[model samples]
Target chain A: DAGVTQSPTHLIKTRGQQVTLRCSPKSGHDTVSWYQQALGQGPQFIFQYYEEEERQRGNFPDRFSGHQFPNYSSELNVNALLLGDSALYLCASNPTAFTYEQYFGPGTRLTVT
Target chain B: EDQVTQSPEALRLQEGESSSLNCSYTVSGLRGLFWYRQDPGKGPEFLFTLYSAGEEKEKERLKATLTKKESFLHITAPKPEDSATYLCAVRGTGGFKTIFGAGTRLFVKA
Candidate 1:
């Protein structure tokens, strides 16, 4: 069975531009959550998507948004990217929102220039 | 606010040596504590999950034990391959969001 997968292993974007990262959750999973891992720090939650709607969010600003499709795939979009936006974007998925065990993808490294 | 803190920003252990890493958390109505191993440039790999105090889980040379406020990951006779960043996270009764710690970087030298 395939695990969670993310697209565009790496990306480079300039300030004021927007970027979208994609994620396919693990098979048999339905909930997708996004996280940002800055250099030398642990990952911070961005938001979570369940039932094709955003269910919960973290302390992130409005510029960070996400979507969950019917197929359980997810996309994280960051608008007006800043230099600080450079980080590793990780996607985690679980069978349900209440499930504690989440499987993660390889992650997409976003480099804001 | 829910928070998690891991001790010893980094650790260096010689091959065949044994050591333990710590993860301390403060949250309301604890649901579960998770342990993950992350290699350089890779996402975290789930290691173990502890739901309550006095619970313990073991895999290979690693063992994880949980208490009310803390958890410990014990590595026995570690090898170079065991070198990686160990992350601890916690979930509360509020929602699905899991708060994570800064993580402990482990370097097992051969």
Candidate 2:
């Protein structure tokens, strides 16, 4: 089974612009989470989606939003992006029964110029 | 608030040398403690999960142990290929969020 897939492995956007990152969860997984990892730092949770609805969110600001399709694929959208938004955006999938067995995608590297 | 803190911001070891990374957490109630290994330019890979205090799990040269307040990832006889940043996270009770630590970077020189 495919572990997890993401689109546009790399992207660049100017400050104040908007960007969208995508992810397809692993097979048989119902929950998906997003994280932002700065260089030389661990990932920080952004939010989580389950059953096509946001189930939890982290300390991120209102500019960040997300959508999870019925198929469990997810998209992360950022509005009025800032230079601070530049980082590796990660997508992780987890099964309800196996909470700790999260599988992560390669991640989309977003660079805000 | 649930939080995880990993110690020894970075470590360098000769190949075959051993070391341990620490993760301490404070949560209302613990659901699971996780350890992940992340290579440069890649997302994290799952290493081990300790569900409760005194629980231990192993895979190859890596073993993870958990206590009520902290967890440890012990790498024995590490190799160059094992060099990576080790992250620790916690699953808390009554919440869907998983809090993560800053992580420890390990470099094993062959």
Candidate 3:
């Protein structure tokens, strides 16, 4: 009965570099979504994946991409990271895309230096 | 554009006091409104979800109520442990993307 789990509790990256963060969804969940939370701000939706296909995306640019495996795990990849990209990366999962009740992970602290 | 706005950027209350946080939202064809509690540097923890106006949900010392354009999270006899940033979010008929507000920071002092 493990909740959502994210890899690399913390990470550091240089400008223009690429970073990949991983997430394992809660058991019995089939859909996964990613969000970015800046300091003192609420999380902003990044994208969502269902059945190994990206179903929807937010206002993020092409630099932000994701992949969902058959096991329901997800990976968020940010390319050409900027200092502004420094934030808490959160992974959320639900039973389905329309479930609306999402369980979140502890989040990965990404610092783009 | 779908948007969510939470009021009183921050609030401070003494232990045993009661208060409420506000979340005003505007979305075309609303689907659901959600409340979450987030500790500093941590991801948000789901608190409650309201699907339609007049719907209410309660857990422990917290109660959440929803209206057509707004939602309220009422905390009763809050304690220091209740101190955290409360977030409001919504999902519309557009897609699975949930729009979030800036959040309200609550500090319950002992």
Candidate 4:
């Protein structure tokens, strides 16, 4: 009964660089969503993936994108990173699209230098 | 626009002190309100979920109650281990996105 898991506990990237963070949802979950938590602020929704397609997105710019594999794992890619991109990237998963209780993973800390 | 607002940016209390945190929300149609506890450098851990007005849920020393306009998380005899940021979120009907409030940071000193 493994819970949601994320890779690369921490990362450091320079401006104009690209980075990809990975996430494996809880065993029985099928929907994956990504969030960004800036310093001293709450987590903000980035986007959501289901059935290998992005279903809903937040106000984030086009530089942020995500994908969901068949196994329910997900990847969040950020391109042309800026200093403001430094934040904790969190992944949450729910059993279905309508489920309200989402299990979260220990997020990946991205440091944009 | 759907929005969630939490009060008291931060709070410090004695080990045995009791207090309550507030979360107020405005949305078109309420679906669920969620509570989560998050430590520094860690993701949020699910706490309780309230679906309708007057719904209440309890776990250990924490109790959550909901109403039409707001929710309250009551802490009883809190300990140092209870120190963490409590986040409140809301999901509205016809959407999967959960709008979160800037959490309330609690520090229980022993």
Q: Which candidate leads the pack in lDDT?
A: 4
In terms of lDDT, the poorest run of 10 residues in model 4 chain B is: B90-99
lDDT winner, 3 or 4: 4
Go through the candidates in order and give each one's DockQ. 0.89, 0.80, 0.87, 0.87
Each model's TM-score, in the order given?
0.99, 0.97, 0.98, 0.99
| Model 2: pairs clashing at backbone N, Cα or C within 3 Å | none
Query: Which is superior by TM-score, 1 or 3?
Result: 1
Decide which is better by DockQ, 2 or 4. 4
TM-score of 2: 0.97
Worst 10 residues of 1 chain B by lDDT: B91-100
RMSD (CA, angstroms), candidate 1: 0.6
lDDT of 2 by residue, A46-112 (tens): 9999888998899999999999998999999999999999999999999763475688999999999
Task: Give each prediction's root-mean-square deviation over alpha carbons.
Answer: 0.6, 1.1, 0.8, 0.7
Q: How does each model score on lDDT?
A: 0.95, 0.91, 0.95, 0.96
What ordering of candidates by TM-score runs from best to worst? 1, 4, 3, 2
Candidate 3 docking classification: high
Task: Sort the candidates on lDDT, descending order.
Answer: 4, 1, 3, 2
- The runs of at least 3 residues in candidate 4 whose Cα sits more than 4 Å from the true structure, single-residue gaps closed, are none
The DockQ value obtained for model 2 is 0.80
TM-score of chain A of each: 0.98, 0.96, 0.98, 0.98
